[model samples]
Target: MNKEHKIATSMYRKIAIDIAQSVADGKYVEGQKLFGRSVLASQYKVSPETIRKAVYILKDMGILDTEKGSGVEVISVSKAREFVNRYHEIESIHSAQSDIAHWAQKQTQEIADVIQKIQFIVDTAERFKNSSPLTPFEITITKESTVIGKSADELRFWHNTGGTIIAIKRNNDLIVSPGPYATFREGDIFYVIGNDQTYAAIKKLLFE
Candidate 1:
């Protein structure tokens, strides 16, 4: 949180708690009149506004009674103890909320960092693929392909597409150098290599 907010909140809350504790301890008994706002501010080394806020908290909790021109008076020792207990409970909840917010922010940052790293890796791989002539391109066999269920030898694969199949990925298995007799199956990922026009020829021969 902001430093100014911390000072404003903590100072007045501390003063209020101190006054309530005094009342609870019998240092200030019930029905006893305490100093005015300015005098209490001077005594506590705070501004009159701070004293007013502190007194307001006590009065709101029924621990103190305040009047405009008169003064502050202790109303109930039991209520003073209740106010202190309630303040501590609220402080505990605030501390837990702070901890949860801190961790959530940290996790969000870590997830962003991971996404950035993955994007960098993907961009680097794409650059390498585009720069290398030997890197094989991939195409998936679909139901529309005329070559589906046909063996490479029967379709005269290399003669038709002017490309060489390096591997066929079927399901979880990689069939490296699937020779002329290897039949094309739906969902097969063909890893092939050729000149620039080879991919277009393969697509035309298979789909058109």
Candidate 2:
């Protein structure tokens, strides 16, 4: 309803996105119960209610399911993979729409700003529609990961996995299209683009 509320909503959207990416990266498996509200809130440094809101978003996206006895868990792996392939563009469009709708509700923006937001929404839609088959998924670099603490070249990451790390989200900053010299570290989330074979290799390297 207000600027502060919009900001909070956007933050929750981000939290929801991070969770979906984590699922896609196999950090959280399908049919596996997710972390509790307090734990997730702590991890994202947000309130429990914010975590709930993020979970609600995931439910709406069909990536999460809940029942009385079973509790909360990710949906089928097929659906989860579908979400991973397009969630970024979906988030962009959703955020743009939310911004535009909020501005309309408050009558707080100039015509130019409204146009810019609309263009962003349109551009995101276009990109999503035209995306290639090599859409990337997020993968965290853990201490046990073979690539951890190694440069891409030293590990032959791209060659071995047949995927390229297009982005690295370390802490609060995101480095897009990082080079081979960009060494991996524990806790870094790498955005990797590859095919089914590439994904299998990645999963074997990271999980098994």
Candidate 3:
């Protein structure tokens, strides 16, 4: 149940959607020739005819174009992948047909203006999630640093500044999750994780 039978009939279309998604994600750049039918079929565990059928769907969507002897090349891809994911959520045959039709219609519309808007939204969301610039950044312990030649406890880095040294790169090796007993050498670069304000305080404690 659960549309597996319909999946059998529409397997080629699903395969085409996957190929289109790869194009949209920049995995397969535009004008890049795809593998031959047999190779693609082997990769997807399908028959060569199935691959051919999928290529036809992509060609119809304008995501791919096939020349006489040359293989298919990607043309353009927008947020077309949403339709691929949406198709799996459809319950009825009518809904599935309607979804595919809508996807085809949108393929012909203008989407160059929307990609930048979508990218801006994505960037703004990331910025909102990561509001601090400190972000577990790294700093090398120079010879002029006050904290050099001092143990973590002797320096009382956490006492003066709330930053926690998560790791230290000494020589060519890495000391991970070091405790307070871990000594700081002149050349050891410490990777610390703390709030934005705490890292600023740590820098002041180290150099000044």
Give TM-scores for every candidate, taking all chains together and pairing residue i with residue i. Answer: 0.49, 0.41, 0.38
Q: After superposition, how far is residue 25 of candidate 2 from its true place, in Å?
A: 1.3
RMSD of each: 13.6, 25.2, 18.3
What TM-score would you give candidate 3 relative to the actual structure? 0.38
Summarize candidate 2's per-residue lDDT along 75-114 as a digit string, tens digits: 8656666776687678789999999999886664455555
Best by lDDT: 1
Ranking by TM-score: 1, 2, 3
Error of 2 at 91 (Å): 6.5
Higher-lDDT candidate of 1 and 3: 1
User: Candidate 2's error at 57, in angstroms?
Assistant: 1.3
Q: Over 4 Å off in model 3, which ranges? A: 1-8, 79-208
Q: Compared with the true structure, what per-residue lDDT tens digits does model 3 show for residues 97-156?
A: 999999877764525334544454346435644985435667898999987778988888
- lDDT scores of the candidates, listed in order: 0.84, 0.77, 0.75
| Better TM-score candidate (2, 3) | 2
Instruction: Give residue 26's error in model 3 in angstroms.
Output: 1.1
